[model samples]
Target: MVGLHLDDIDQRILAELSVDARLSLVTLANRVHLSRNAVKQRMERMERDGVIEGYTLRRGSGPSRRVTAIMLVYRADRMRGAGVVAELARIPEVVRCDILSGEFDLLVTVVAESMDRVGEIWEHVSALPDVENTVTSVSLSRPIDRP
Candidate 1:
């Protein structure tokens, strides 16, 4: 499926999946206005072409069940140091890490089981060699979360 082109239908399938990867083939097909088999074929082709990668679980944001925190990280060497990013990737609690422009070098998103765990992760991230400073803010509520 190299050099594969994604048509409008394929794009719709991807959009729906991005919102909820756990959607059943039948439900996905219904949302995309395609037959189940056709949708499945397109999904399989997209997977082969690397357009659709692996699926993952999005944990529930139940009160006290999960803690979401964002860390504003300033790197000592800025983007020139890739080591910090590599080390951040090894931490399972680090769900997202984005290199940013301006004041913050990295914006790290962590989802942990508890606030204590998030604090531990913060300590670990702060200890990384190239990490200069970090300011963490725990999320109180999530009104809109769209993938």
Candidate 2:
């Protein structure tokens, strides 16, 4: 969250990518007012510097659905650790998870359809050793971040 210097062009490129991740090099050039080759080089540079994450398609108004949920999993002991988090990340439905503060030690964002599916996922995550308690909250809509 800190120590990152962002120039105007870097900010614009990030904003454009947020709108559409798979934007072609030429399209990016047009949007950023740089040459296609230069845009490609900048993209590669950003990725290498960890400023830009990977690209993925935006799920549209079709049959497919992605349900994002915020989960709080309380462990019996405080040592769930990064290994456990890495294991959870391997689960197909779990988009990401992080160790957090306060009432919950582990916070997770999962993409699953149906309460039934999330219930099933609960079984998988809760069954891990020392996982004593769990709470879940589902997101009804996406929060758009234009930046």
Candidate 3:
């Protein structure tokens, strides 16, 4: 907590919310020794101050029916701007994308309902204007996963 602006109560609020952002105001208030309205005001203030960015669902920990694949993309233009990123964001199956510094320009994680859908996504990505080549690896099993 050194060099940080958060007080003890604010830190506790963030800590509790990190574990369960859906916690009701009453529960949070009881945990933090505050009224429901006080907790709500603190949360709202934190959100406004950018101390809390936004809540997100942590994936890959629960049971899923989807298949996941990693695609290594070689872009012809080498990510000239946000065009490729904007396009990637449009694809609902593209869970994550990273710019690389090796044989490929981008690494993308695709999750889909079936192998057929994964192939379709691959084709769609390859057809993008900036993409030159791609290599896809399907994840068969994950023995070690942090999330």
Candidate number of the best TM-score: 1
Model 2: per-residue lDDT, tens digit, 68-121? 678898877776455456456445466556678888889887767567788788
How high is each candidate's TM-score?
0.59, 0.52, 0.57
Q: Rate the local accuracy (lDDT) of all candidates.
A: 0.81, 0.71, 0.79
Highest-lDDT candidate: 1
Candidate 1 per-residue lDDT over residues 1-147, each given as its tens digit: 444566557766765665567999999989878899999999888888877779988667663466789999999998796778767755656766788999999998887778999989999989988889999999999999884
Backbone clashes in candidate 1 total 0
Candidate 2 weakest lDDT stretch, 10 residues: 1-10
Identify the superior model by lDDT, candidate 1 or candidate 2. Answer: 1
Q: What is the model-wide C-alpha lDDT for candidate 1?
A: 0.81
Candidate 1 vs candidate 3: the lDDT winner is 1
Query: Looking at candidate 3, what is the lDDT of residue 142?
Result: 91
* Residue-level error in angstroms, candidate 2, position 128: 1.5
Q: List where candidate 3 sits over 4 angstroms from the true fold.
A: 1-63
